[model samples]
Target: MVILTQACPIQRPFGSHLYKRRRDFQLLDKRSWSLKPLIPRVSEDQDTDYQLRAVAKLLADEMTANGQVIGIGTGVAVNEYLREISERLGDGRLSGVRCIPSSDVSASEAAFLGVPLTTIEDVNGNVDLMVDVADELDLENLAYIVGRGDNGPQANQPSLPRVRQLLEKARVRVVVVDIAKTGRRLGGSVPVLIEANEDIWEDIAEELDDIFIGDAEIRRRSVNPDAGPRGGNSPVITTDGNMVLDVQFLEGLKLFGKDEIYDRIVAEIETVDGVLEHGLVVGVARKAVVGTVVVSAIGEDGQEEVKEESGPRVVHL
Candidate 1:
């Protein structure tokens, strides 16, 4: 029954509605594309590794020979996709493909892998396809939780505002995740990570704490034992100089359930004055690729050996 007294309007949801089509190009029109039903591919190798590779290949197939302005997302699975795209670029299967990276780590990986890069402004903010991984994916609604710091603060994860911009501009937004990252219903098992203005982070956290019944805290930097507490020990600052707050939910609380409390809380948080961006990503992905691993055998050495590795499958969102 808690409420935010100074809440602002929640930002409009990011989705196909936000995409702007180029007058001259029909390829940018997502309506022209049709997603196929889930098709499972099985391989006999490292289940996780094979699944990641299969996903990378699937994303590479989305690129046309004429090239595409792709939005590259961060994380390990995404890195594998970048490598796949780079290999295709080297072999001339796809040319003129320019990538707009979502984070510093992704940009660096793309550059190192020889994937052509461009800015959103240079491309006039028109993206053919966006492929990024999700931290927590809602299978039914295609919603996800992003920016939860899988790579740590040094990875320079893109701010929520920037993510919003990229998603808004992209014509086809696709999310990739391992099957383990997905769930039919999202719950309070994960903290809701929020970014707020540095000056007002404490205030924002306090407000969120009240809303969540004292479940919010300002995320701090990890300190090296040898270095002790230095300036690095200060609160973690995002690439945009904003502070991140890890707001937990009451134990045993389930989100996105029958009561739809998740939607209500999200609206409340969005209205909070100093709130910048939040981790909950809903209605942004047009489709998702979920990588699954199946262990088909138990080896004599006590290691899991799959007779066949299950590859990732595409799910229409």
Candidate 2:
């Protein structure tokens, strides 16, 4: 029964009346475009690499083209999609795709895949599409949370990521997740990652601990940098060189009986002093490509067996 308190009204849920009109991937003007429901849902246990590749391929076909600037994010899913992009580029189906990477990890992967790489600076203009992964998805809410390794924080006076800048930089933000991760349900321990000032992370963590009580907890990511060559003795630093915070919310935690607690919490954290960018991505993802591998039918023994398929259809959300 945690509440947002008067301290943070921006996190407050807008009236249900307003949510009604805006629900269902309507961040962009609903009149602008329409998505085809070509792919259908399969199994709840649809967390497979093959399925992930299937999702990547769909995006590769739909989003990529020659002489386009693409923004790539870091993650296993992005890597797979990059492989698809490379295949297309290598075969000359797609050429001159100048990729803008969000992080160093993405840059390295794109380099290895032999995809032409560029930076936000060298984009020359707006990016054609930015593909990233989501740790969890709330279909009903039409929002997703990033930062679970499935996507991570610190503080003093809170700092906000120049989110406006990112929004202006990338033309379109599309989130891709496997079938299992897409639903009204929230998954994993870390819902959002916040980057904070190093000197005041202790206090920042304490503040979160107070506001988000119960199963909600804050963790600081650490790495040992002094052990040896591949050391692991220092706190993990972001590209911006800030401390990291992992915020976990209890399972099935909801507010206003219908709204997602994770969404609510992201709002509260933003109002806190010394806070920076959080992983709750809102308004960025206009369309989502969710791929599924459905194994149905029982064997002679009455047990369902795994089946292999290629180029599985994707459910566009």
Candidate 3:
């Protein structure tokens, strides 16, 4: 069996807290009362690199078997994290752990580093843990969005679906991310990537009156002399072997309500023929382990004063 493992360096210890507080309530009846605000606090401090290192350690510490397989998703950010993990594992910090990467890019990187690779078929009855970063996560943690890179379609391919299936089989799914990616609302910071079939791409773009095509851009894995237009002239590609249409919203579109907005758009798009997959991820992560770092400076009196600097936190699965 092939073993996949990676290592990353850590500069400090990081942690996050999740708290829920009930607000004051007035009793109107014996069985009913008007409750006030319920607050949920999530706090973390760490840079993108630091959070990735911390996540590697967390995964290594939590993994039970030496020869067990772990799944990693693709992206520039995820690749950095994997590089750190692979480095640490190379130094003997972690042993006998194999990796199953989410994309061709990730698979190539893993193979280059001498890490063993496996497919869903290779580990037919074994447990595989996938750790990936998300573009957005909502308050209830029910909805998530990913595939911000130009390779949305490939990113969602058998890798994502297969990981979801494996996680469901294991009865648990863990997501690792920095705190900045977590918020009460979704899509405010990151734009959603939607994949539509070539046949219905034009029709769907026309039907979604709320969605506007932002720009025409090329979707290439890397720069190639044989490739088509480098910038605006190139065509977009989806992972499912279909064309992609970039959809945007006007400044004042009616997207106030989350459920209503998602329902309306998803329902409309699904009804259209030849729609392969949309970028809406509902109920993605069951649990998130966020990592934050605290930096301390030495004071004049030779004492240390701790200060928090924010960048990104790692969400662990």
Whole-model Cα lDDT of every candidate shown, in order: 0.55, 0.52, 0.42
What is the lDDT ranking, best to worst?
1, 2, 3
Please write out the lDDT profile of model 3 over residues 1-317, one tens digit for every residue: 22222223322111112212222322222211110111112444434555555545444554323666667666544565466567767887667777776667778888887777776667774544555555555534435555544345444433344434444433223444444556654553222233533344444444332222221121222223245322133444534444443333333212322234444444444544444544444442223322253222222233433333233232323
Q: Is candidate 1 or candidate 2 better by TM-score?
A: 1
How are the candidates ranked when ordered by TM-score, highest leading?
1, 2, 3
Candidate 1 C-alpha lDDT tens digits along 1-317? 33223222332211121222111211112222221112223335447677677667755654334668888677776788889878877887777888888887888999999888998899888887666667666766556667766645555565566666777777566666655556666544333344534455555555554444433332323323232211144555666766566554444223222235344546656656677677766662244444443212111233322222345444554
Whichever of 1 and 3 has more TM-score, that candidate is 1
lDDT of 2 by residue, 1-317 (tens): 33333222222111221111111111222222111111224564554575667657766765567887777655666788889989998888888887776666767788999988876666555666666555566654445655544233221111113222333465555555545566766644542344545566666666665555444555665554233311124665655666666665655443333444444545566656677667665442233333353222122233432322443432234
TM-score, candidate number 1: 0.69
How many clashes does the backbone of model 3 have?
26
Deviation in Å, model 3, residue 256 alpha carbon: 9.3
Model 1, residue 298: distance off in Å is 39
Q: How accurate is candidate 2 locally (lDDT)?
A: 0.52
> Residue 281 in model 2: shift from native, Å?
1.4
**lDDT score for candidate 3 against the true structure:** 0.42
RMSD of 3: 17.1
When summed lDDT is taken over every stretch of 10 residues in candidate 2, the lowest stretch is 17-26
